[model samples]
Target: MRRTLDRLYDGALWLAAVTFALIAALVLVQILGRLADRAARAMDLPPPGITIPSLAEFGAFLFAGAVFLGLAGTLQAGGHVRVKLLVRALPEAPARWLGAVVSAAAAALAGFATWSSALQALDSLRFNSVSYGVVPIPLAIPQGVMTLGLALLAVALVDSAVTLARGGTPAYRASEARTEADTEASTGESA
Candidate 1:
């Protein structure tokens, strides 16, 4: 189960990366289309009419996918912003409790977002809603992707909270420890 969850998280992160790449590709195509049109017009020729339909809308949707899908991977990697100063100020026992509480709250919020997004997606699907743009896109598709990401993030937060409650280090803490160890090793080697 643990291995499966890890794989799922990894897959989500990979999907996010793919979405970002797609956004870049789409933007590039849009730029090239515009440049080609400009050159044709300059040459007193009929404009090639090259254009990426709904490029802005598509880019926006892809950007959102990248962000939402990356959340779980970022948390697991210890890349999410955290207030270390506050955590360090607390006693060890209190710190542990605080960490668990924060994780729980995050899980709750993520779960709510997941549920709401899923419902919205379902509603969109039921209504057969389509985005208004040069290229009509079914709204439910992107919403479903966002919901999946939120669900993955909620699972990660709950796992962290449970690990803390059991007096075990969370994935993010372990990740941080590994990073610090690597940094120290590199510094020692340099010295």
Candidate 2:
């Protein structure tokens, strides 16, 4: 189960990376197209009039998808901002309890977001909603992606809570520890 969850998060992160790459690719192509058009115009040739129909809209959608898809992976990787000063200052038992409580609360919020986004997606589907761009993108598609990401994030948070409650170090906490240790080692070596 742990392995499966890890894979799921990794896959989502991979998909997010792909989306970002696609955005970059689109921009590159657009730039190239404009350069070609400009060169043609400069050479007394008809401009190809090359342009993406609704690049800005597509970019916005892809960016939103990428962000939503990255949530779980970022959390698992300890990339999310957390105020850990209090937790670190406490003894093991109290720190564990506090962490568990915080994780549970975050899980609840994630679950709510998932539910709400899913509902919105469903509603969009039912209404046959589409984006107001030259290319009519189904609004449900991006909303569904958001829902999936929120669901994964909720699962990760629940996993963290359970681990902390069982007196086990959560993946994020372990990752943070390793990062801190590495930083300290690097500083000591430099000194």
Candidate 3:
């Protein structure tokens, strides 16, 4: 089950990567189109005026998708920015409890966001809402992707909270420990 969950998280990150790649490709096409037009005009010829329809809108959607889709994986990988100074200052037991409390709060907030986003997506789907652009894309598609990402993030937060409650270090803590260990090793080697 753990392996499956990890794979799911990895897949989500991969999806985000693919979305970013698509965005880059679209932007490249748009840039090339503009350059071509400029070249034609400079040659005193009629510009082809070739442009990617809805490129801006599509790029925005893809960028949002990439960010939202990467959330769960980022959290799991301990890549999310966290203010750990206070937590590090605390005693072991207190820090553990504090971490658990923070995780629970994060889970609640993420769950609420997931539910709200899902509702918004459903509403868009019901109304057949489409984005205003040269090409009309259904708003629900991006909203659904956002909701899925939020749901995954909520699950990860909950898992971390449960692990902390059970006296197990969370993945983020483990990652930090590994980093600290490596730093110590390097320092010792230099000494």
Give the total clashing residue pairs for model 3. 0
Pairs in clash, predicted candidate 2: none
Tens-digit lDDT track of model 1 for 39-146: 999999988887889888899889888899999989999999888888889998889889999999999999999999999999999999989998999999899889
Model 2, range 61-120, lDDT digits (tens) per residue? 999999999999999899999998999899999999999999999999999999999999
Model 2 Cα shift for residue 182 (angstroms): 1.3
- The C-alpha stretches of model 3 lying farther than 4 A from their native spots are 182-191
Candidate 1 Cα errors over 4 Å, as ranges:
181-191
lDDT scores for all predictions?
0.92, 0.94, 0.91
Model 3's TM-score against the true structure: 0.91
Q: All predictions: root-mean-square deviation over Cα?
A: 2.0, 0.9, 1.9
Error of 3 at 51 (Å): 1.5
Please rank every candidate by TM-score, starting with the best: 2, 3, 1
User: Which has the better TM-score: candidate 1, or candidate 3?
Assistant: 3
Kindly report which residue pairs in candidate 3 clash with one another.
none
Clashes of each: 0, 0, 0
TM-score of each: 0.90, 0.97, 0.91
